[model samples]
Structure formats: C-alpha cells, structure tokens
Target chain A: MANIKGAVVVNKERCKGCDLCVAACPCQVLALQPTEVNDKGYHYAFMQNPDACIGCASCGLVCPDGCITVYKVKL
Target chain B: MDINEIIKPENMVYTKPRLMNDNPMHYCPGCSHGVVHKLIAEVIDEMGIEEETIGIAPVGCAVFAYNYLDIDWIEAAHGRAPAIASAVKRLNPKKMVFTYQGDGDLAAIGTAETIHACNRGENIAIIFINNGIYGMTGGQMAPTTLEGMKTSTCPYGRNVALNGYPLRIAELVERVDGTCYVTRQSVHTPASIRKAKKAIRLAFENAMAGKGTSLVEIVSTCNSGWKMSPVKANKWMEENMFAKYPMGDLKNV
Candidate 1:
C-alpha cells in the first residue's frame, strides 16, 4: 500500500481562532497566522505545512468551531 | 489524484455535521460549549433523528444553541431546562428530547428540577456543561467550582466554610435510581472528543429507546473566564478538574 496524503479546508470566516485545531494536529501542519486575521479579528488556523499531513483528521476531530474539514487521498 | 482533487466530497474524511447550521457560533474562542454543540449535531445527524430531536436550551452561554443547530429547540428559564425537557419528552413520547445546561444552571439554579426529573425517570437526555464558573455572567463561582478555584464571586479561592464543597452532580445523580446512563466526559483532545461523542450517542439512543434518564456531563472549560488560552485551559482542566470530576462512566444501567 502506498502512503496516505491529506488536506484540510479551514472555514476562515467561521473560525473563532481558538487554536484547538492547531494544537490537535499531530503532523505540525496547522498554525495560526501571526499577522493575518479574519473578519472577526481572530487569527484563524490555517494549514501552514500542508505536505506533512497524514490524513489523521486529528485537527478536525478537536476543532471547537467545526471549521476544519479533512480530506484524504490514497496513493 | 492530486491533493487538490482529493478535496472532493468522495475523498473527504471529515466535515462539519449537516445538522450544524452555517451560522457562526457566538461562543468565545476555545469555549468547550462549541465542541459539545458540534458533537450533538453530529450525533443527531448520524442517528437520522434531526427532525425528531428537540433540544432544550438552558439560559446560559448556550442559550443560542437553537440558532446553531438545525433542529427544534425550546428556551427554558434559568436552571429550569430539566423541567422543560421533562414536559417536552412526556408530551412527545416519540421525540428524542435533551437539555443543554451549564454548571450554574444544572448544579445550582436547577438542582431541584434536575434531581426530581431524574428521580422520576423522565425519558430525556441531559447534556451538562460543567466549567466550574458562570461563563455568561462574568465568571462567578458555580456549584461545581473546585475547592480553591478563584472566580469573580470567590476572589480569594472558594472557601469551603462560606461556599460549601463543590457538588459532584454526576455522582449524586447516578445514585438517584432514575438515571440509566450517567457519564462524565470532556473534549480537550481528539481521543476525548471521540469518547464524548460516543457518550452523547448513547444518551440520545437511550432517550429514543424509552429508557430512563441519561445524563452526559461534559467537564468543559471557559478559556475567556479562566483568563487562559484555549490550550492552557485544556491543560488546566486535565490537571485540576479531572482529579475532582474524573472522566468515564459513573453509572451505566
């Protein structure tokens, strides 16, 4: 079996920038933008290192705002 | 397929629950109530009971639960959610009724109604959020506050002599003979979130199966009220709160 890859779509507008998803990520793929803020003035989580994700969905699982959607691809 | 192509619905491993409305929640960043709300919406959608579920929104931070959830809801007076949920379940036997309450609402304001409804074996699920402080009203000491926890009301930590001990509401309700399922769970991490979601499913199932009362107490956190970041609040909960209100099933009959 080949390696599994993953991607995450963050609903920036709805994200409250709670940082739960950023901490829940196992691959260190997510982070809060230090200089950018959404319309709500919150620094929402974003996939800073998209290549490191392994489709674990850990970020999505712990997201309080339910703003992270996980997608997986099997090679 | 390219990673871009994997973003399609077929490759999606997880997304927001359908029952969760598109409205942005009003909860503060890292508020535990949002996770619980998401879990409830996921459970209701997975069970295919969106229309048959009626949520009783307690008068607290989660009073706007109806707006976030795409289901019917009833607003109850402060600490009166259990009584309202009992009536809703009794009147609509086929409906899956549940009350979303906070520590101040459940353990303090609605103590009598909660115990009596549970004692009477009302076929309704109760979702309790125990953050140990009144999050909505500016962080006042609640009935579930820890022994030495500081809040607006108890600025110098809770004094047992003046405020009495923190009530273990789950322990008290589990022994009431009316509750069929009683569990204390949290959503600080991925593993705990899954467990809490399962607990919610079980409680909802019990409510729909004509079983007795089921209470799922979520030992949550109020990052804004606690004066800590979301991550620090979760760590504090795991350290301070878990020792007092340990997670896992207190009673499952």
Candidate 2:
C-alpha cells in the first residue's frame, strides 16, 4: 500500500484553478498547469509534487473551492 | 471526461491560466483578498469572459490584484475603481467590466466615486472585500473599521464619539438606484464561501446579461490587523465581525 504520507490530494472536480492554493502553500508544492476540465468546465489546480507537502493545510484553507486535502505521516 | 468529474480541485490548475507569475502581493496571511481574487478568476473562467473582461484594481491590498487575475486590468487611483470602471464600460459596452476594491478604498476615499458609478447604473460587477481594517499600509484604521476596534492609527480603540460608527458599505450601496444586486457575505467558513461564490457568479451573470451594476461585498478578515492567527482570525470574524456586517443579499434586480 502507498504510505500516502505528506501528500497533497486535490479533488480536481472542485478545483477552480484560481492559484490561491498555490499562493497559500509555503512549501511551493502547488502550481497551476492547464491539464483537464472539472465538472465546472474549468481547469483544476494540481500539486507539482505530492511528497513536498508539509501538511500545513494552508492550501486547503485558502482554496476557495474546498478541493485540497493535505495528509501527513502517522509519525 | 465528465463535466462533473472535471470540477474537482486537482483539475482546476490550468484551464485558464493568464497572469500571476510576475508581480508581488502585499496581503498578509488569512487575508481573504486572495480568495476574492480566486473567485473572480473562477467567475471569469466559468463565464468565458476572460478575453473580453477588463478589471479595475483599486488601492489597498487589491493593488496587486491585477497580477493574479489573468484578464486585462488597469490600476485605478485610490478608491476610484468605480469611476474607471464606469469609463471603461462606457467606452466598450460589449466588454465585461468589473472593479475589485477593499473597504478602505471604496467606503473611505472612493465613496463618492463608487456611489456615483452605481447611481449612474453603470454595467459592471463590483467585488468589494471588507476586511474591517485596512490590510495594507500596516493595518491602519479604515472607514469600515468597527467601532471600539483598535488599528494602527487607533491603538486605543476607535471611539464612536471621535470616529463615529462603522460604515456598512453593502447596505449603503444597496440603496443606490442603479445597483441591481448587492449582497454581503463572509468567507470564513466553507458554507459561506460557497454562498459567496454563488452570489458572485450571479453578479457576473447579472452584469453579463446587461442587467446593471451588481456588487458583492465579501466580509473578509485581516489576521495581521486583528492580531490573531489564521484559525483564530476566522473564528473571531464569525464572532465579532458578523454582527456588524450581516451577510445576505441586500438587493437584486
């Protein structure tokens, strides 16, 4: 099974590609890239690297779409 | 593949990228200015108005809003976003025009300009972020700062006898004859954020339909000014700020 620790998971469906999450994340783990359309017909924000997440939840907090989730190791 | 599937957060990264790589933002942590910018960008993206929309960025924390929003934005004089919005819409009626301003810029210095713009029934969307205190200029007192609140300039707490009561811009703006829709909502909670997005989307739709000027005032928070952490700031906003600036649609055409 994947350890899935310190990973940032984006709902993609709820993402609005506003970049607010990117701006909020202090670790710079998030970046905007035109990829696929969500149910809203807009591009969703994605994580540049899931391993870089510090799980500060700043991305989740600032996301207007409520589409981000930051998980940390059980340590 | 499915539109519903596409609306997920992971997918929203680049469907409508424009500006944001350059320029610097001056807002502090937990400031709702960024959220407001995101909502506006979402509205533009969903409405397909990016190419034709022109934004007027006001002074205050929103001074750098143009940097984040991909559409063509013109920096307006302090509190003059509405005046510039008026001129821009008049010049190109077909184009979607909007002004993003903060309480300090709108209610304080730009009150006359904003009031007249709405009174004239200008076709535009006005996104007003009211974080109580002025986020920029080091959290100074703004016209909308609550009574008994302490700011940089009002460290002893604002005296109603001296500063008077806080100004409710959303309520005041609703009374304007030309404003079609005016609503005040908070962004501290998920439910409120969703509601704000809906209201904002409606405002844009209203303007796009040529209904008239629509304004959505988001009751935001400035953690730095309120002297609270991000989480504490959100909670404090719910407890203290909500009573002063009640949320809901004040008017709609």
In TM-score terms, which candidate is top?
A: 1
The two-chain DockQ for each candidate, comma-separated, is 0.86, 0.08
Q: What is the C-alpha RMSD, rounded to one decimal, of candidate 1?
A: 1.1
Instruction: Supply every candidate's count of residue pairs whose N, Cα or C atoms clash at under 3 angstroms.
Output: 0, 29
Question: Whole-model lDDT for model 2 versus the true structure?
Answer: 0.76
lDDT of 1: 0.92
Q: Over the stretch A1-75, how does candidate 2's per-residue lDDT look in tens digits?
A: 133235567777555565656756677888766667776675667778655665566677566434565555433
Best candidate according to DockQ: 1
Chain B TM-score, structure 1: 0.98
lDDT accuracy of residue B253 in candidate 1: 86
| Regions of candidate 2 where Cα sits further than 4 Å from its true position | A1-61, A64-75, B1-24
Task: Please give the lDDT score at residue B107 for candidate 2.
Answer: 92
Cα deviation of B247 in candidate 2 (Å)?
Answer: 0.8
User: How far does residue B230 in candidate 1 sit from its true spot (Å)?
Assistant: 0.2
What's the TM-score of every candidate structure? 0.98, 0.75
